[model samples]
Target: MLLRDKFCLITGASKGIGKAISEIFAKEGAIIIATGRDLESLNLMVSDLPVYSAPHLVFKMDVTKEEDVLRVFNELSQNKIFIHCIVNNAGIMEDATLQMVKTDLIHKIYNTNVLGTILPSQNAIKHFLRNRCGSIINLSSIIGTKGNLGQSIYGSSKSAIIGFTKSLSKELAPLNIRVNAIAPGFIDTDMIKGMDQKFYEKNLKAIGMRRLGKPEDVAKVALFLASDLSEYVTGQIIGVDGGMII
Candidate 1:
């Protein structure tokens, strides 16, 4: 229970990696503020977590909406729950080649992936700065570090997130808050389900482990970054890619 009684806010926590992280955080004795767009699934997660009773709070939110985010934060603040860590994990992937991309899709992906990240980070920082002690973990992807065909839009958004994390770390270092990014490769989630066969196989073959990453792999890194174990680590990008970057 390295993070006993800590309050963690995780975005996109209805299913997949987000939900997995929430459960892991809870089992580590952290109270979770889990946000997701699907109310039913969110409720299920709140009930499914392994922690003791009342360790989780679920908020139905669309990460792209500033108003929704603001309202949820306000509600949490009013309840007097201090946020100790924030995980920015909400993202949407819409892939198309440079020439084949639509203006509308580009805007949609950026709103959900980029702006979705920026707004919550800004909001969370307010709470973090108040305590002068907190951690912000941005969920980036290996695509941001290396390009793949038809991944221009998705990669760009994630790249922006990683870039933002680095810059934000410098800005908030004096406040005693750490900011970092985790670049995960081909995790077994629906996000990877859409990857072209050739692209997925090429990446898997490149991995020294000869396997795809799991949500728990990323969740473990995130837990370390969120806890005091990473007190000296900040403003960096770590890959949970099974040595693919090697």
Candidate 2:
């Protein structure tokens, strides 16, 4: 019950790592506000979360759209639901080599990965400032820190997240708010499920642990950052990458 009675908002919460985080947080007693583009999927996921004193909510949000992001915050405010934590877990990845990458693809990647994180965070910061206490957990990727082939656009977008997390953490620390980023490596998720078989096996060899990480593995680290356990920890990019970089 590390997050007992806390209200946590998780974006892109319909599937993969985001869904995993939602489940774990709910089990620990956090009232989850799960958002995603698919309303049906979000509702289905919410239906499965562990029950708590405060019921979980499902919102259809396209993280790339500022209007969508603002609407969710406004609606929550109208209902007097003050979120204690925000996990910017909404993102997309379409890996392409430099030559194969197109301008539209780059825009798509940045909008969802970079602007997606920033908009929700910008709105969350307003609420956090009033409370003078909050937590913001951003999801980065190991590919951002350690460059990879055929993923230039996707990697750069994640790198932007690292910068955003570091700067915001410093700005909010004095107010007792925390901002941290989790850079997970090659987790078993839909994002990586489409890789070529040989490419997939090659990635397996790159991990020191000799196994792909599970969504729950990343979720546990997120739980730490969202709870009192990480009160003294901020502005850090934690790698849930199974020593992939080492």
Candidate 3:
């Protein structure tokens, strides 16, 4: 049990990669705090988590809203729940060409992807600084690194995450806190399922493994970062893209 008794807060935990990370962390003996915008889906997800001595908890958290993020953190403090790590997995993807992008759409994407990550991290980092130990695992994307045809806004937002991860890692490493980011490739999630069949097949051919990566694949890497296995690692951008970039 790599994370026995550890408390892990995973955002956007109702589906896809976030849900997979929450389940895997629970199976590894971590007490899970699963949060998302949808209370019902979050509840459903928590109900199925692997049981442990400390039952998994669920909260409706809109990571983009400062009030929502603060309220949850406050409640955790009130309950004396000290999290060992926080996975900033709450994010959204809206694709459009530069000319087709609207100002409102830009705000929407940045609000969810950029500010969404920062608010939770700001709260988590405060807690980590006080404890002198914690892990911050952020989700970036391979699209952010290798430019895609129709993902300028999404790519820039994820790229911001990579910058945040590196800067924060350096700032807190001296205090014994770690921060890192995972840039996953075209994962087989709702985001990818809606892709045109031709585009999907093209991606498969581009991937060295000739297959789309699974949510579990990203979750497994997340587990390593959350656990002691990555105690010495920080300020790194880990690519979970199955050799797609190589």
Candidate 4:
């Protein structure tokens, strides 16, 4: 049991990489608290999994709202379930250069991607500090580090996330609360499910693997970071991108 008797809170767990991580953690004997905007889809995930069907708590949360975040944390804490891991995976992308990006769009993206990471992490840190043992794995992106064109708003949000994770790692380390970030690249997801093949190929060629990454590929590394395996690792950005940058 890699995460024996642990409780993990995974945001954006209705689908994609978040869902993948939740499933992996649950199988590792960690009770999962899964959050997403869509309760129906989250419930569907719960029904589909064979891990007692209810180890995943479906939290209908809009990560942008601080009150909702604090409320959920309070509710979960009241149950006496000490959280051992927090995966901040909820984020949105506004694809456009800085000049072309709308102010409103920038606000929306930051609210979720940046502040979403902030508020929830604050709450998680509170619980983790009390226990003196925990892991916080934030979801950044290769876009944050490499700065791809037409991704200014999205990239900025993720870049900010990396800074936040690094600083928080320092602040929380004394309490034995480890913080880290995972930056995934070229993952095949529904958002780009219908993208043109030519564009994908052009992008895929950047990676040595010559293919798009799967959500599970990222989840495996996340499992490592979330468990005791990387307890000494903190304030780092790991690229699960098939050697794109290297």
**Candidate that would win on lDDT:** 2
* Global lDDT of model 3: 0.91
Candidate 2, residues 1-246: lDDT per residue as tens digits?
A: 899888899999999999999999999999999999999999999999998798999999999999999999999988988889999999998977999988999999999999999999999987787767999999999988897999899999999999999999999999888999999998999988898999899899999999999999999999999999998999999999888852
Clashes of each: 0, 0, 0, 0
Please give each candidate's TM-score.
0.96, 0.98, 0.97, 0.95
Model 4 poorest ten-residue lDDT run: 47-56
For each candidate in the order shown, give its overall lDDT on alpha carbons.
0.88, 0.93, 0.91, 0.86
What is the TM-score of candidate 3?
Answer: 0.97
Off by over 4 Å in 3: none
Candidate 2 local Cα displacement, residue 60, angstroms: 0.4
Give the runs in model 1 whose Cα sits over 4 Å from its true position. Answer: none
Better of 2 and 3 by lDDT: 2
Error of 1 at 42 (Å): 1.0
lDDT of 1 by residue, 4-70 (tens): 8888989999877898889899988888888989989888888977775456888988889999999
The C-alpha RMSD of each candidate to the native structure, in angstroms, is 1.5, 1.0, 1.1, 1.8
For 1-246, candidate 3 gives per-residue lDDT tens digits of: 989988899999999999999989999999999999999999998899888779999999998899999999999988888888999999998888999999999999999999999999889876776667999999999987787888999999999999999999999899889999999997989888777789778888889887889999999999999999999999999999988952
Give stretches of model 4 more than 4 Å off: 50-54, 194-197
Clashes of 3: 0
